[model samples]
Target: MKQIRNFCVIAHIDHGKSTLSDRLLEYTKTIADREMQDQALDNMDLERERGITIKSHAIQMYYDRPSDGKQYTFNLIDTPGHVDFSYEVSRSIAACEGALLLVDASQGIQAQTISNLYLAIDHDLEIIPILNKVDMESAMIDEVSDQIIDLIGCEKEDIVLASGKTGLGVPDIMEAIVERIPAPEGDPGAPLQALIFDSVFNAYRGVIAYFRILNGTMRKGDLVRFVNTGKEYEADEIGVLKMTQHPKDKLEAGNVGYIITGIKESKEIKVGDTITTVERPCEKAIQGFEDVKPMVFAGIFPLDNDDFEDLRDSLEKLQLNDASLVFEPETSAALGFGFRCGFLGMLHLEIVQERLYREFDMDVITTVPNVSYNLMDKSGEEYTVRTPSELPEQHTIEMVEEPYITAQIITKPEFIGTIMTLCMEKRGTLTKQHYLTPERVELSFDLPLAEIVFDFYDRLKSVSRGYASFDYQPIEYRETDLVKLDIRLNGEPVDALSALVHRSKAEAFGRQICKKLKELLPRQQFVIAIQAAVGAKVIARETISALRKDVTAKCYGGDITRKRKLLEKQKAGKRRMRQFGKVEVPQKAFLDVLKL
Candidate 1:
């Protein structure tokens, strides 16, 4: 049997992990000679556009060594760099025995890089430190290597300096993988045992589950049962990913690839679940795998009532590939029907929104994302609400609490004051601050998860002139005086725009919502008044001026259809606005409140 090495490529965001993977694919000729695409591993258009790997992808390649006169197969897994999908990355790590840790030569070690490195260490993977982006003029190979040594306790001599963009050190990196990273040691002769790391849906092939053969070989037509769920299926086909080129098939034991079974849904197979033959099923799967829990929740609605079913179907399809995503039918007395969608973090929420618009081709109305809250009622009954609209009345809520996070902000020393001030403004409690270098500092803060969720990172980057890196992990839930701000257009409430804010920032939030409404909603023939209130008190209000010339002066017979169409469009637009009795409030008013 051929020797196999399974490893993952890990790095901070934009640290050249994907680029490096592409070059390696080219060097190994995994793709056809004529096919040329940048970052071949980043298969999704949204992922390419955002310049981040949202999902983990696996590819297999064969390397021929002239020195040893032998061929070796390498199973390379590319993992996400964002902390929001850390759980997915961890699963990817579990399927591999080593990781190619990429660090940007110019940018040095980043927060997420350290975070992922620790995960690799926890997995007991041999680390191969690669200093990427060496083609850039600003690339500081020595400095970045030293920083890696300081942060990760790696020997400076162990760092490999190469440019992933130009295919500089890929061959050497591949050779190092075969030499340093141990080959899979499990016995293929044992009972069939494979761990499912990921699964995808195909229109013609059904569910394709990507698994790592741990202890045994799985052949085509083997009656395999999911060890965790007791569901059995016949493996119709086995295929390996040749990522260097476009993805090709036919994966084998001691390799990483996908298996096509008659199973129609990706939900039936889960990450960390084991697959084995019915005759000799494994009694236990790998431990330490936990179901991902979402931290942020938002309501997803459609502008047109006819689009509600479309939106729901789209979400269901998305959830099939993403187990971390959570959603259920939710309704507001005012907004009719929607879904309360839960995400792992702000980036997760943004990715979902982008996918809903780009992939599903659906225009979505998303409310302000909020963390789930636990509230004590006057009767001392405990209740958990994901949205403000579901919260108890202010008088009835005896105590309110929201989730908190431990945030680490890395920035230049010069902008420390601004970052601290902004954190303080968000009600952040200072925890500790340390200077990583004479010019660079790492600041820690205990802050409300809500405070950091909305554009706090953007604001920090702006204030630091894009020189700051920030990361946070959920710490705990803390008590706070939180209130649900209800937005009304004219007299009716816009449930889609309701927000939970600290009692201290209610008036400012109301004004911001009103301003956003005025900008988003077009001028109507009739006057529109947008108001934000808590209970019976009006906290902020803004007026959208009436359309000055809504009617056409000379309506020719041919222009009648055009005029009617215009009027119909205007009427349709008006329906989207919140109407309380007779008052009309534009839809923008609800959307703008969430914009930072």
Candidate 2:
């Protein structure tokens, strides 16, 4: 423990956390040149393509100080840089003694950047402020350094300027990490106690748990158990990360590594659970370890009913790796068997959908995502509703409360007008605004989570010309005039197309949804009327004209009565078709509703 330095790197999305981790691994010779890969810490293709860290990763490095001829062990962990994964970031911070706060030299501070820094501070971890990407010509190194000093409330003396792309100042940054960051302290003689911060599911080897040993020593072939679940298994292997798995006979206190217990079922292991020897169980589990709570939710249905069980199995395997994802079996009247899933935010929901489609090769249709709402009846009984279709009747409710979030946006000042307009359109109230730099400004707003879950981020990017970045944290549930809006095709309401919206914007939104559906739904043999309604009252409507087949083309010459009879016969057939015809909604229409 005396020679071990346990620390993590944190930053905003695209602020070079993964790149910095790569530089550190290269400098310390943890991974060889042939073995090195792009965005090495980011194992998922979604993360590499998007240039964001979605999960936290840990690895071991040995850096020898040439000045003193002494080598130190470094357990360098990289944390996710988005607000949606803050829960994972927080837990990763808890396992470390220090963190390197990387701020992009060109972009400077951001909403998520500040939020993650505060999380490190709350854990009382020693923070090394490092300005990254200094090699770029666009980098304003001096200005960003000053911002760091002001934020830390200290006269800057030891700020490290570095670039992950060019390997500039990397040596200095490594030195600061060793000299300033304290080594982790723990008792190796105590009973076994380790914390599972993250995990992954492997089909051949079962569940592999990534953990930091907090107390005692764990070795290969030991009988261990999960403290919370009371499940025991024989440790098949023990190892530290060497850019790849490197087996070790044992792991000491304050060291990070993986334990293979041969637990094939992914559901058996849980993140934040305590792991220890079955014969040497501790008196109690560690404090401050809690399950992640999901904020936004929606129903995900497999397009083919036969694949429902396959979807369930895939989700179960996914849950073994992602502790934040929660789901329960549900059935929709129109969509048949499906699951109602709970997620941390909209991005989380999207990632889940993408993975289900790409990883499992399953065709799925997702309903509009919704934030959980609190409702009360006349009898004072309170209940939580997650789907718009689950909203109670208006006559029975006493009050409705919707979840609100604090949005933080950083963008060029010229786009301020468009952003403000967009915010107000979503019923957002501006709380504060200030200039971070001469050209870039930060805007804070208190808005409902429902507003942001759909197209808020996309519109912000469009209006800001892709120069804006956003982050948000769920605040509180506030009373609002909210109503459940249902979409009707022809004459019948579709439960899968329902949504909850503010009463003030319900009618206009209904009109917009109706119009979009009219464009997306193909013209049929009979006229189709699209209507948006609240209860029995319709607020907006759109009509799709019936397809004409030229019924009278067969008659070259005929009596007027004969022509009229042919037209009458065609009208009766159309009337009968209208009564029995069903609208076949395509998958793209379900996706277009999210944009509206």
TM for every model, in the order presented, reads 0.90, 0.96
Candidate 2 has which clashing residue pairs, if any? none
Residues 1-596 of candidate 2 have per-residue lDDT tens digits of 77789999988888998988998999988888998997998888988887888878888899898888888999888988877888878988988999999999998887778888888999899999889999899999888888788787755777888899988888998788888898877788888999998888888888899899889999899999898888989999989976788999999898999988888787788888899888777788877456777878889999889999999989988887677899999988778999999998888888888878777787788887778899998999999988887788899889999989899998889999999999998999999999877877999999998888777878998999978889887789999888999999988888888888889888988999999999999899899999999988999999999998657877659688888888889989998999999987877887787656
Pairs clashing in candidate 1? 30-245, 31-244, 31-245, 239-250, 239-251, 240-251, 492-580, 517-589
Those runs of model 2 whose alpha carbons end farther than 4 Å from true positions after fitting are 410-417, 433-442, 465-468
lDDT of 1 by residue, 1-596 (tens): 34789999998888888888888888888877578687788889988888889998898888888789888888888888887888778888989889999989888877788788888999899999999998899988777777888887877767887898788987789878988898877776778778888876667877778888877777777788987777988878777777522334333457777777777655577767888888877666757367777888888887777889989878766776676888988887655788889998888888888888987898777778888888889898998888876887788888988899898887788998998899999999899999887767889999998887777877987999988887778878889989889888776787767889898989998998788777887676567778999888999999987665555555556756888887777766655643422544456645555664
Identify the candidate with maximal TM-score.
2
Q: How much does candidate 1 score in TM-score?
A: 0.90
Candidate 1: worst 10 consecutive residues by lDDT?
A: 243-252
Q: What is the lDDT of residue 520 in candidate 1?
A: 80
CA lDDT, candidate 2, residue 58: 87
